[model samples]
Target chain A: MEKAQEIIFAGFGGQGILSMGQTLAYSAMIENKEVSWMPSYGPEMRGGTANCIVIVSKSKISSPIVSKFDSAIVLNQPSLDKFEHAVKPGGLIIYEESSIITPPKRTDIECIGIPAMKEAQKLDKKQVANMIILGAFLKKRPIVKIENILSALKKVLPERHHHLIPLNEQALEVGRKFVQ
Target chain B: MGDNESKNEPRLMKGNEALAEAAIRAGIHAYFGYPITPQSEILEYFTLEMPKRGGVVLQAESELAAINMVYGAAGAGARVMTSSSSPGISLMQEGISYIAAAELPCLIVNINRGGPGLGTIQPSQSDYWQAVKGGGHGDYHLIVLAPSSVQEMADFVFEAFRLAEKYQNPAFILADGALGQMMEKVVLPEEGSLPYTVHNWATSGMGKRKQRNIITSLHMEPEKMEEVNLHLQKKYKEIQKEVRFESILTEDADILLVAYGLGARICQKVVELGREKDIKIGLLRPITLYPFPKTEIAKLASRVQHTIVVEMNAGQMVEDVALAINGKCPVSSVGRMGGMISSPEEVLHYVETMILKHFVSA
Candidate 1:
C-alpha cells in the first residue's frame, strides 16, 4: 500500500545514535526501498546530544525532515523527555531502560524499555548497544529483515570493524528477545 | 564498472560526499577548498580520494585563497572546483566576480548556511539573492543549479561543470546545510566517466601555437570594459534558455508553490498532504536558480489562483516569483530563518488556513 515509516533515533554523540538510524536506512535501501537519514549536526557534535531521522518508504520520500514520527528509539533520558510528545498517538517508543530514569508520560503510545546497554555489557561490547535497540525495533515493526542489516553493515562498517558483525548480530538477537 | 561487482548498486551517501564523488567522476583535474561546517566532508572526501586518482586536492588557507586557486587552475584549462558555506561564499565574492569577468569555466559549490554575517551554521536560502543576483561586483551571473535530493546533489555536479564550460562561466551548486548533512541512497557515475574537453583559450603553454592566450578581468580602457559587459550580457541572454524546472500536479492546481533546493523537498511533501485534502496544490521546483524558469511560472500563473514562494529566508525568492508572475496572480512568501526548516505540516497548514480558506474562498 506504499506505507512510509519515519523514525527518530536519539542519544548523546558517542552513543551510535546516528549510525543506528544509518544502518536502518542502508538496510532499507538494500531492499530497493527509498530512504533518507537526516542527522542533527554542527559544533555540538563535539560531544553534545545527537539524533537522526530515518525515513523508509515504498514510494519516493518527499522530505528528509519531519517533526512527528511513527516511532522513536531513544537511548538517554533527555531524548525521552524531548521526543515523548513528538511520537504520533499509538506509535512506538523503545528506550534504554537503564539510561531513562523517568518513565515515558504518554498513555496512548506503546513505550517499551529495553536495557540495551545492560544487554551490550553482557555481550562485552558496549558499542553494539544501539544494534540491540535496532533488533528490538525490527521485532516490533519488522520493516526490514535482520539479515539485510548485517549485509548493510558490510557496506557501511570499515574493514577492521567487519570482525564485529557477528557480535552485532548477537546483540540484535538479544534485543529481539526482550520484545516478545 | 571498473572492478566493482556492484557498480550499479545504490550507496547511501551524504550530499556533500556524493558531490565530491561526482566531481571526481566528472574528471575534475583539481579541487581547492577550505573547510566549513556541513560542507567540510566534500573537502575531506576529496583529500582522501583525489590522491589515488592523480588529481590535486588542496586545503587553501581560506575561502579567498581557494577560489583564487580555482581561477588559476581554470585559466590553465584544468577542470577545477571549490566549495564553502554562506559566510565563506561572501568572502569569495570579489574573487568570484573576477572569475566571472575573466569568463573562466569552473565549478563552485555553496552549501549555504544561515545569515547576514557569520550566521549560525544552519540551513537557509538567504544566499538566493547573493547567488541569483550578482554576489560580487559587476554585471555577471553564475549559472546556478539547485539540487533537491542526494541523487541530484551528485548529478548536478556533472551538470554544473558541463554548463560552466559550455557557457565559459563559473557555475554553482547552491545547496544548503540540511541537504549537505543528510544522507540518501544514490547511484553514482562511474569513475572517470566524463570525456576530456579541450579549452582553446587556455594559457597552459604556447608550444609553437600561433597565438599566446592571456586571462585577466582587468581592462584599462572604459570602452573595453563596456564591450566586456555587452558580451557578458549577450552570453547571459543565451544562458536563459537553459532554465530547468519541475512541475508537479499543476493540471488543476488552485495554489502553486515555488521552491528550490531543500525548500522544494519540504514543499513536495506539502503538495502530497494538500492533495490528500483535495486542496489542488502543485509545486514548481526550479533546478536552475539562475536561468530561472520565469516563463514556466508565468504560464502556470494564468491557471493557478495564487502562488507562494516557500523558502528559508524571509522573502528572498519571493521577488523573483513575483517578477515571473508579473501581476497575473497574487504571490506570497512562507519561510523559516536561522536554519529552521518549515515542516510539512506547518507549510500545509499555511496553505490550508492562509491560502485555501482565507484567499481562495474570500
Candidate 2:
C-alpha cells in the first residue's frame, strides 16, 4: 500500500491558499493518485481565516478532514500559529517569511521560510506568491510531477489567463531553485 | 457501460459538482433548485451546464417552488431534479409527498446538514427519518440512496433516475455536507444517453393517444385511493427485494458495525484498527437506505455476538437495525449529533467498552 500525504494550506482568503491546494489536488488527479481537497467553507472564507486540506493517497480516502498533517504550507503569521503544532513530528512546515514575523519554533519538524512575496515580485506579479510556496512544497515533497502541475494549471485557470502560463511556470522554477 | 467505455476521464470534482455533471450527462431535461450551502455548488454547476446542454435550469423562488417545479416537469415525462440541504428539504416535503403520491419519476438530492431548524452547515445524517421513513404527511417511501464517495455521488444520479423511472416513484440521494463539500477524483460520465421517455404516461397535450394521462395525487373516491396506496405498497415491496448492501470482513467477525454513507466510511477505518489489535470487527454498509438491507443485517446478526450502529445522528437508523436483528444479538448505537464528528479512536474506544468489554464479561 502506498503512503498517504495530508497537507494543510492556510492563510488569508485572497492569498491563493485555496487555489494552491486546488492545483495540488488537480495535479494529483492527473497522476492517477487518490486525492481529496476540503476547503474551509462559510463566512470565514471571505476575508478572514481560510484553509484547505489536501490528501493524496494511493487508496480510497476514508475521510477528508485531517487532525494531523504530513505537511503544512502557511502564508501568514496567524496560519503559522494555528497550524505549526498540527504538523507531525519530522514533518515539514513551509511558510512565507514576509508575512510571518515569528517563524515556527518546533524542532521536530523541518521548517523552511521562503521569501515568497519577494520572489513573486521579482517575477513581476506579487500575487503568484502562492505559486512560489507551491513550488517550494513540490521541491520538499515531489509527490506529483511538475509537468502534471503545468497541465493542471491549464485545466483550472480560465481561458483568458492562458497567456500568464509562462510567468506561473517561471514562478515555480524560481521557488524550486531558491529552496535548494 | 456505454459512456464508461469511451471518454470517461478522471477529474478532480467536488461531490456536489459531480452530481450536477452526472445529471447533465444522464440526460436530465430540467433542473429546478434553490441555493443552499454545501449543496449550493450543485445549483451553481447546473446553471452553466444545463443550459449548454439545451436543458432548463431554474433558480426557483424558494425550495417549495423548486420541488413543485420538479413535480411539474416529472409529470411532463422529463427527467428533472432539485437539490437542497436539511432546512430547505423540510420546506420541500409537501411537494415531495405530492410527487410520490402522484407516482411521478423525479430525483431529489438532500445534501444533508445538521438540523431540526436552521442547523449549522456541517455534515450530518440527522435526516435519516426524513429520507428513509417519509418525512412528508403520507404513507409512501422514497427510494433513498446514501452515497459515501465522490464517485458514488456521480454514479448514483444515474441509478436514482433509473430506479425512479422504473418504479414511477420519487428517488432521493441522501448525502451530507462532507460529501458535498469535499473534492475527490471522479470519473465523469460521457454525454449522450437516452433521456427519460414516458410518453404514454406523460400529459403531453394528448398527442396521438387514445386517452389523456391525468397526473394527480388526490383520488377523491376512497376505494380508488386505497387501490393506489396498495399499488405503492407493492412497488415498495419489490424495492425491498432489490436492496443493495456491502458487508466487509464479516466472515469471522465477533462484532458487526452497521453504518451508512460517511459513517460507514469511518467504520471501515475502525475495522482495520480492530483487526490490527487481533479483534474481530466488520462493517455492514447500507447502500440503499430506504430498502434498509435487512436480510444481510439479519444474517450477520445471527453470527455476530454484538452489533453497533454508528451514524451522524442521534440513533435514527438504529431502530431499523434492531428490528432487523429481532433480538438475535444485542444492538446498540453510538454517534455524534449537531455536526460533531466522532473520531475513529473515539468510536473504537466506544466499541471496546460497549461491545468487546461487555462480551468478555458476559
Candidate 3:
C-alpha cells in the first residue's frame, strides 16, 4: 500500500465528528497501517464546532501536520465552510447536505454531498449521521476494508452501543450503495 | 518466536494501564496519585493491580498531598511515582521542588491538557515549559521524557524510574491527554528485567546499615546550599551528555519542523507530505525535553536552512529550540494556545511561506 493519507473530519460537537475520525483511524491501524487520531477538545468540542485529524500511513509518519488534506468529511455548515477550501484539488470532500447549508464552491475536487442526517432519521436513528459520513468516507477512500471497520467499531464501542452496530451497518450499506 | 516469548506477546492496552504495568515491571514499590483526566486510568490500574502484586497504590486527598506522599516514599528509599494532567501537575510543583532540593528519586507523569488556567480536558502539548523549565520554585531541573505512543508510554515509565535512580533525582513522563487515553498494542517487559536495583542507596527502614539516614534539604548555611546547587548542576550536565535525541529527513532540508509529544507525531505527517512534493523538509522530535537533545539540535542547525518550532502551547518549547540553535540558524515558532493542537496543514503552510521561503529565494 502507498503511504497513509491524512484526513480531517469537522462538524458540530454532538455530531460525533471525532468518533468518526477515530473509527477510521483505529480501523486503519487494525489493518496494520500506522495511524494517529487527534481530536479538538475543550471549548472547541463543547461549542458549535469540533474537528479531528486522522493520519493513516504505511511508513513511520514523521509529522502529522498537513498543508493540504487528502480528504475531508464536513457534517455541518461551519465545518463545510472551514474545511472545503483546504482539500487538495483532486481529493474528496464528503458533506452532509442536511446539516451543511452552503455547497462547496470549488468544482475541481470530488464532492459527495449526502443527506446523512435525513437518511439516519428516515431509519429512525437520527444520531447515526456520523456513521453515514463514515460510510461515505469508506466508500470514497477504501483504504481499510468495511469488514475491518465493523470489527474496529465493535472493539471500541461500549456495551450500551452494541445494539446500534447493526443499524450502523445498515446505514453504512445505505451510504455505500449511494456512493456506488 | 520461542514458546515463552509467544506467551508474553504484546496485548492491546490503554496508555494509562501500560504505564502502571511498566512501573510494576520496573520494580516500583509505591504509587501516589490523585484522579485527573487522561491520567486517572493509571491510578485505576494501579489501584487494582498494585495491591495484588504487593505494591503500594495510594490515592491521596489531592495532587498536593499525593506528590508529598511520593516525596515521603522516595525518602524512605522506595521506587515511587505520581501522575496528573496540567492543573493537577501545577498543584504538585511545590512538592516537586522539594523532591528536587532533597535529591529524592521518583517518577512523575504529566498527561498534558490544554491550559493557562484550567483551560480544557483535552490532550495537548501545552505543558512544555512547565515540564522542561522548572515548574516549581528554585533553580533545579527534572529529567522529562515525552512519549508519543502507548508503547513508548509504557517503556518510558520503566526508563524514568531507572534514570531517576541513576541520577538520584526526579524523572517525568511528559505525555499528553491523547497518549494517556489512547489504546494501542504494547508488549510488557519481562518481570525483574528493569535495570534498577537501588537498595544499596535507598533508605530502607534504617536497619543496621551504618546509621539512620535522614533525607532533607534544610541547610541554613548559604555556602552549604550553594554546594548542593553545584552538585545538582553537575548532574544536569552529565544528563545532557547522556541524553540527546533527533529524527530524520532533517539533513539538507529547507525547513526543520521541531515538536515533541503529540505535536511531533503530527509534524511527522507534515514531513511526509513535504517529501512527496520534493519540498525538502525534516523534523527534530525531542524525546527528552529537559536534558533536551540540545547538542544534537545544534548540529542540525548547520545543515537545515531554517527551523519551525511547532507546539500546542504558545512557543514554550520553541524557546528552548531557539536557545539550542543560538543564532546558528534562524528559528521561528508556530503554536496554538488554550489547548489547541496545531494542524499539519497549518504547520506546513507556515513552513512553506515562512521557513522555506528564504531557501526558495536563494
Candidate 4:
C-alpha cells in the first residue's frame, strides 16, 4: 500500500464533481484509511469550474490542499485544460471523453478517457456520469476496493435517493467494464 | 448523523457540520446564526439536527440580530451558540462584549475568512488580533480555542461550551475557513454528560424563587464598572494559567515553528518535510489562542535559536510570539495575507531560502 494517494476531481458544478470526490473519500473512510476531502467553495461553485481534492493515506494527512495530484478525474474540457498539467510526471489523468473534445496531449502521464456521458445515457440516467467516472477511477487507481465504493455510495446518497442504488451499482459496473 | 448508528466507526464529516453535531450531543439549547459563505453549513446543519433534538435553530436577519439573540438566550440561562465568518463576526463583536461583561456563558464560533474588511471568502487567520485582542470596544478576552482537524472541530465545541460555562464568559472557537470547509475522519464523542446544566445559572422566569434574576452589563458607576473589569481580568489570568498547546518534535530541535489552526496543520507537514531533509525543525501548535501559550513558547525560545511564526494573516500572532520570546531569540514570521493561501511547499521554500539564510545558527 502506498503512503498516500492525492486525487483531484474537477468539472462543472452540476456534474456531481463534489460528490464523486465525496464518495471516494467516504470509501477510503470505510477502509479505515485517513482521508481529507476539500471542495472548491464559495458562490463561484454554483455554475463555475468546481474541483475537489481528496487525499487518502495510511497516516494522518497534513494539508487538505495539494498543489500536485497523484491522479486527476476531469469531467470537462476546461478541467482537463486546468488539471492536465497538475498530474505528476507518472500520475494518471482519467477524463470523461464526451465533454472533452481536446483530450490530454501530455506524454508523461497516463490518460484514460471514458465516454461517461454516453455510458450514463446508456444507463438511462444522465446524472450517473459522476458514478461512471468513479468506476473508471477505481479501475485506473484501485486505491480502494469496489465493495468499499458501493458501501460508500450507500452512505453518501441520501435516503430519498436510495432507490437509485441498483442503477448506480449497474453504472459502476458499466464504468468498470469501460475502463477494462 | 444519528446517535444509534455504528458508534465506534469513524465518520467523514465537514468541520462546520461536525461543530453542529457536537453541539447537539453536548445538549446545546439554541443556535442563532446568519447565512455566510464557508460557514453557512454550520447554521444549516443546526437547522436540521437541532430541531430533531428539541433545540431551537434560527436564521436571524443579520449577524447583529443573531449574536444579540445568542446574548438573550444565554442571558436567560440557555446553552446557546452563534457562528459566522470574518465580516459577520466583526458585526457580532458588540454583542459578544456585552455577553462577556454580563458574565453570560455562551459558545461563539468564528469560522474565519480573510479580513480587515469583507476581504475574500478564502481561509485566513487575520482575525487573530480581533479574536485575542478584543474585537469589541472593551477590556475583555475570549477563551479562544483553535481547532486543526474535523475531529477537533467537533470535540472542541464540547470543551468550548464547558469553558464558557465554567468561567461565565463567552468561548470562541477560532476556526479558519479551511478547517470549516475541509472534510476528515472524525470519531465523534458519544452522547455523554454535558459540561453544565443550563438551569444552573440561567435566569428563567422565577416562579418558586423569591428573588428576580437580572442579566445586564451596564455599570453606569465608575466603581462598579472597575470591579467588573477587575473580575474579568482575574478570570483571564486563571484561563491563561490553563492554556493548552502541543510542542511537536521540539525536544532537541534547533529551529522552532510557532503556528495555530490551519497554520499549525501546514507547519506540521513542513516539519516532516524538514526532518526528511535532515533539517531539525519543531512545531509549537497553540490550541488555545486567547490564553496564548506564552509559557511554552517562551521556554522554546530560550532553547531554540530561531522561531518562525507562520499564519494566514499579515503577522498578527507574530506579535504575540515575539512578545512571549521577548528578545530571548530571534522571532521572524511568514504569512499569506489578502485571502491567498500559501501552500506547504511555498512555506518550505521560504524557510529554506529566506528564513534559514537570515537566521543563522547560534
Winning candidate number (lDDT): 1
For B1-362, candidate 1 gives per-residue lDDT tens digits of: 11243666788889998899899889999999899987989999988888887799999999999999999999999999999999999999999999999999999899999898888888888899999887999988999999999999999998998899899999999999989999998999876667767788999999778989999999999999999999999999999999999999988899999999999989999998888887899999999999999999999999989999999998998998899899999898999998888999999989887887667853
The CAPRI class of candidate 1 is medium
Score each candidate by Cα lDDT: 0.91, 0.89, 0.81, 0.88
Task: TM-score for candidate 1, please give it.
Answer: 0.97
Say which prediction, candidate 3 or candidate 4, comes out ahead on TM-score. Answer: 4
Residue A16's lDDT within candidate 1 is 90
Residue B64's lDDT in candidate 1: 92
DockQ-superior candidate, 1 or 2: 1
Better of 1 and 2 by TM-score: 1
Regions of model 1 farther than 4 Å from truth? B1-5
Instruction: Please identify which of the two predictions, 1 or 3, would achieve the higher TM-score against the true structure.
Output: 1
Q: Write the per-residue lDDT of candidate 2 for residues B64-88, one digit (tens) a residue.
A: 9999999999898898999999999
Interface RMSD of each: 2.5, 4.0, 5.2, 1.3
Q: Flag the better candidate by lDDT, 1 or 4.
A: 1
For each candidate, the DockQ is 0.68, 0.47, 0.33, 0.68
Estimate, for each residue in B146-186, the C-alpha lDDT of model 4 and write its tens digit. Answer: 99999999999989988888888899999988898889999
TM-score of each model, paired residue for residue: 0.97, 0.93, 0.85, 0.95
In model 2, residue pairs whose N, Cα or C atoms come closer than 3 Å (at least 3 residues apart or on different chains), thus clashing, are: none
Candidate 2 Cα errors over 4 Å, as ranges: A178-180, B1-6, B352-355, B359-362
Worst 10 residues of 4 chain B by lDDT: B192-201
Error of 4 at B241 (Å): 1.9
On a 0 to 100 scale, what is the lDDT of residue B217 in model 2?
93
RMSD of 3: 4.0
